[model samples]
Target chain A: MFDEHENGYFTEETSAEVVAARNAKAEDERLRDCVNILVKHIHAAIKEMEPSQEEWFKTIMFLTETGHTCDDWRQEFILLSDIMGVSMLVDAINNRKPSGASESTVLGPFHVAEAPELPMGSNICLDGKGEPMLVRGRILDTDGTPVADAKIDVWQANDEGFYDVQQKGIQPDFNLRGVFRTGPDGTYSFRAVKPKFYPIPDDGPVGKLLRSLGRHPYRPAHFHYILEADGFESLTTHIFDPDDPYINSDAVFGVKESLMAKFDLIEDRAAQQEAGFDEAFYLVEHDFVLAKG
Target chain B: MFDEHENGYFTEETSAEVVAARNAKAEDERLRDCVNILVKHIHAAIKEMEPSQEEWFKTIMFLTETGHTCDDWRQEFILLSDIMGVSMLVDAINNRKPSGASESTVLGPFHVAEAPELPMGSNICLDGKGEPMLVRGRILDTDGTPVADAKIDVWQANDEGFYDVQQKGIQPDFNLRGVFRTGPDGTYSFRAVKPKFYPIPDDGPVGKLLRSLGRHPYRPAHFHYILEADGFESLTTHIFDPDDPYINSDAVFGVKESLMAKFDLIEDRAAQQEAGFDEAFYLVEHDFVLAKG
Candidate 1:
């Protein structure tokens, strides 16, 4: 039988335990654990800060605004999580890879499911305006064997640093998005324009917070990819251009050395002919290895 | 100078530190400190939880829903804070009281400034619904000296446990809310119905969270008050009915032993006549002590 007189009441000293004790034993294990973890840490933070009433209310308002700013077309909370390095942390925790597999990173927010499916060696730069580049990569298993029929979905910002979705009418639908399935040789290739660094939406509450923190909102220019094969784990990752100025300071802390790829200048005529480009072009070649599920 | 090769990239081991370092040298000191506190604790929580990607995104969605639930008429976030014990924690931190001074608690979210200012001993219950109660008190300084002309704004739910605003059409406007000032003798009196224990709105994401945690949303029967006097600190607090079943376990953890008041049945005709009531009624008396600013 429970003690009738014993109750957890509000006090500065027992605040966390009181809050966390609300979780009943009948609750889902996952939720109980998560909420308890959150309660303990949030209370700890509040205790450490001892924020004034005004400051506490300001935080309440910030959370309100961050939540209010989310809608069907935009998710400001995820943006908040991303900028705070939470999305990356969660990604890292969930997608921990084996020693030789490609390291996974953030999937970002611009991916669209209906990106045009195309054949290998097709050009995704429909409105080509920047330096022509050939992106080639093979799908391999960790054991050095080719993984055939692997699907690679890729998307990137335009040369002007805008995604097709961000520009809407300005950029044609699916302008810089494509999907390809590798063949028996496990090789996949496509043509694209060099992506430009772009700023995240800085007009919302998250943006205001970023400004207040003296942090810039631009992410380093990179190509996004989601790779999948029949018996292997699907990978959500990005391929960072090493020469980009913002490589070291991604707004979301998503950059990793293993995910960095070299962009080489190809000048040989045979190389140009093989890639079906008339002149010298940039070649970004990086192979990806996947672990079986 | 910054090194070109070094970056605080996303890594599970260094996530919190990386996020905290993003607060640049030029940012506001207070904001930087608060954000760093938040970043560190949030990362610690995530690290402990190791929440799956779906679970993390569900949290993002929950936040968005909580935010979307707020509007000009309601503030779901504050309610969320209340049920989580955060609002009370923040209030306690900001209102640390001296010995012999009245303890402070949550202001709650239902207070309206439009409550009518009334004479002492006026009945706040426009509708004769529940047991009539005679409530009286004196406002005094920490030294027990009467503090004349002190303002005591009081409000509470009706016998049916509904605030005027919550039952707008059913209850008269300002039915149980009033503002009163003490006399030269520091005595203040009011007539009202004994408030019933009531549950907070259980229809939002916060409610879902509460239900999932096996917690009830009911707050004990209590009268809310805000006291202010010249040369003294303003106090936001509550006086709880000791007989109420939920008195010890408030949903928001707002209850403190010092804030409890005893209600006695007054059956003497002379006393009832003195209270201007034709029949026997309940009498609850509690004095407040405020600290000098």
Candidate 2:
């Protein structure tokens, strides 16, 4: 009688073995194979940790609450994966670039599908709220040759330290956001106010989660970029300001030594006039190398 | 500047890998090592599933709710773990008996630390609310020699399907729960009411968990037993009635082919008179085998 529906009960139909095979057999053989392997190892781990009846019940409740706490805006499972470092592991395994090539960090929660296209040197910071800054960078290939026509998608926080998404009504529609195409010489220049440090959303379940785990919600000031072009690998990198207090202790473990660049404070009037800024200016320059696909 | 310590930030003082390499560690480093390995693997598993931000936050919330759902009568985490099959996994790993020995199973949530002691052949049915039953069994070594003076902790639900724990106010203390000692020949006999099927508690977080996962909460009718002796391995086993409706689908995945037993109904008037019972009776005989230490 037990063998009749073993497909739904155990991985195998036969009870020849004293122990039950711990997973259900899926109709698709490949999915079944994956699930079987996962279930077997999971059961083996559980067997090793002989928790009492009360302990078992508590685990069930935890998983249930994980589902209930989910919504369109908040993803507790993703946060659970991130803090537990699962997301990084999977990302690392999938994106194994050779040494000297830039490493990929988390895409983060603020990325939108589209951004407004702007001129090569137009001010992306429409809010006009921070010390004027000029960012200049060259997109290069593995051999250090310039990659013309590279697309640089960039976004950062405003002077008050909030993304447009977080302060929808308070901030302008595209505050401190733009997509710029590199000039014929592989040079891309942009104007924006200095980015400021901000906290990840904290009023929802993630906030309660951070509080319970005794972790803070702050992220250091950094510029987000996704540079893509033909024949070169797309590079997703962040430029962390050396002065940001949370640079070494980014909550998402995103900061890298190669990603840090100093924003040199320019006091010379000649340099300021050339850059078209009257006040003291901060200048940042870094070249991004794309790995060959 | 990023490396300097801040007032509110915290950091790990010592790394376990370094401590494990030193000779000054505690004598019970094995347990510590085991726990470290477990935590590493568990965390690794979580990282692999890069859940979204909302999902991550929900997981923490779920864990908090699991703790809040616990009370003196119900432990949702334990029930959760049980359904996840972790409890049985722990039991299997801890109890590695040779063939022919009584196999161990989950100790269900209904077990109390203490039960009333009863003499040989005494009836455990204080409420007299179940079908008349006589239970007799022999405790044996793996090679078939009887084990003398073994203590058997036994309990079962009443015919209407309620445990003493479920009805603390109405049912007498330790009703249908007894601690019986084997006679000189490793023989034990007791009269009791037949056990009945019952639902696990559904009002707590575990219930909410089951509802979310689309799982039913039920267990088959059965007798619970824990047999212990001086020089032999302890045995925790259940004698599940094959006729119960839930026999095929015990919620904890606890039913084994060898653990099922038959209960025969007897209408013999002479035997009923000798036992001082009504005209109808039920007889059940079971044998338990303990593994050699």
Candidate 3:
């Protein structure tokens, strides 16, 4: 016969310190240290928040949905960080600026690794699709010395406002994208259509994330850049056009006070005539300074 | 007109400290702290590994997919942490040690909030289905004293080994689930069908995460518990039956050494007769434990 009622019985459990001592036998010291710290920090945060079980589940579910939204073309986690401004914040923290130095901005998610090499003066406008625009810039150091042979990789949305990645099959493989090396005088120039503002991808979980966070998912009109050279710290930044409506509030938080470049109107009708183009004024000169590493 | 040039740029950028200084204006201090620390560790790992762009993208893509796969029923991020053994490692670190005390385990995603209350000895087999079974246990402190009126929330799959959340409409609401209060003698009992081993939900992003990580998604047949009292540290653990195939390697790494309870055969005809049960032998057991707050 089984007796159902039994009282007074307890087990003296071991202490956490004892278990920790026992676990000191683990072979991977680095991994153990890393995991222990990570665990401690995460647990500290959890204890501080004391979130309800429902809230905890919601967080887990949010993460799960983020994973489901990922693919080769879309990275929702990055987008999540982008919208939250965490990516730009991290970039800013890592790339601090000295006084009077050009500020670094976020490296937007759309940079392609390899761009076709183009000569300084060769027009990079493969599609000739947007309003005929010329981007001329000088690369200078802090003291204004021309830094020659600086590698400049640039890409932007066409006038219709679409990056190649956004419309892969529809656009030329490298439409409006090119890599140019600065000339001896620290000068670089290129011809491409004016880029228009476009909304970040909103068809996936990121859209939901944006909605949940009460924010829009639109980036301002800007040109992406990767500037690198020997003896200089590489800069991954974006040059936002001041004219874009969202210039002051890019969804990805990529705009920076120093990264904004003046796009001047080229009013030389004679020059337009000489170039065999329409009399339409277009974007012209801007320059960047690179400090000695 | 655009010029084409190959490679030619060279320049030295600003010092790291200068860059770090200007980027210090973080919008939110709390967010900045979290992100900066995360970036430091993650980037350090990246620097150490020196993974190429493609490899980095793959990891990003993996994270993105993990987010997309999360939902109410399945949590891919938890699955990710589980496969990485991070969850169990964290639990192990946090739960520390209590030699004879029940070991903590992974808090799985299937737990639903607000289980219905049941009187001690009330059958929780709502659907009137599943193999006949009974579970009973006593509450005791480390120093051997009856802990009266302890709350116990218990849930598990049916004999067919499916939770109500898994079957949705097919399962009667709250089937095989109940919350009980220990009697004055520190004992609680319930009747239900024996839990059958079943696969974790594999249709969501958790499945994709598991597949990608080369991990199986299966939890051993066990009963979930959340026991608490005014003076004792709350216990969130599972009782794993020795007979389950997954007793050793729960997909979520939730099984603990101290939490394993043997299901003893009860074939005494007199006991069966007293309980108004069939002649077939079944399992029975109780776990006594000390409570430390």
Best by DockQ: 1
Tens digits of per-residue lDDT for model 2, B1-293: 23333322111122222212321232444434443444354544434443344444454466556656665556766676666555566665567788899877878878876898788888888887878888888999988998998999998888888888888888888988899998779999888888887777777766665555444567778989999999988888789888887776665667776788789988888988776687587888999999987
Residue A263 displacement in candidate 3 (angstroms) = 8.7
Could you give me the TM-score of model 3 versus the true structure? 0.61
- Going through the candidates in order, their DockQ values are 0.61, 0.12, 0.12
Q: Cα lDDT for residue A231, model 2?
A: 82
Compared with the true structure, all predictions reach lDDT values of: 0.88, 0.69, 0.65
lDDT of 2 by residue, A33-116 (tens): 433333344564454554444454544555455545666666655565554344444445445576667666666767766889
Candidate 3 chain B weakest ten by summed lDDT: B2-11
Superposed on all Cα atoms, model 2 deviates from the true structure by an RMSD in Å of 7.7
Please, what are the lDDT tens digits per residue for candidate 3 over residues B1-293? 11111111111122222212222444544433443444444434433444444444555666665665565555667765564444555555556546666666766766778889988877778887656677787888887677898988888888787888888999988998898888788888887777777777777655654554334567777888888888888887788886777665465556655677777667888876664567543555767575588
Q: Provide the lowest-lDDT 10-residue window in model 1 chain A.
A: A1-10
Compared with the true structure, what per-residue lDDT tens digits does model 3 show for residues A175-283?
8788988878888888776677888888887676555444456777788878877777787777877777776556666766667777666678987665446756466
Q: Candidates 1 and 2: which is better by lDDT?
A: 1
Interface RMSD, Å, model 2: 8.6
Candidate 1 vs candidate 2, TM-score winner: 1
TM-score of each: 0.95, 0.64, 0.61
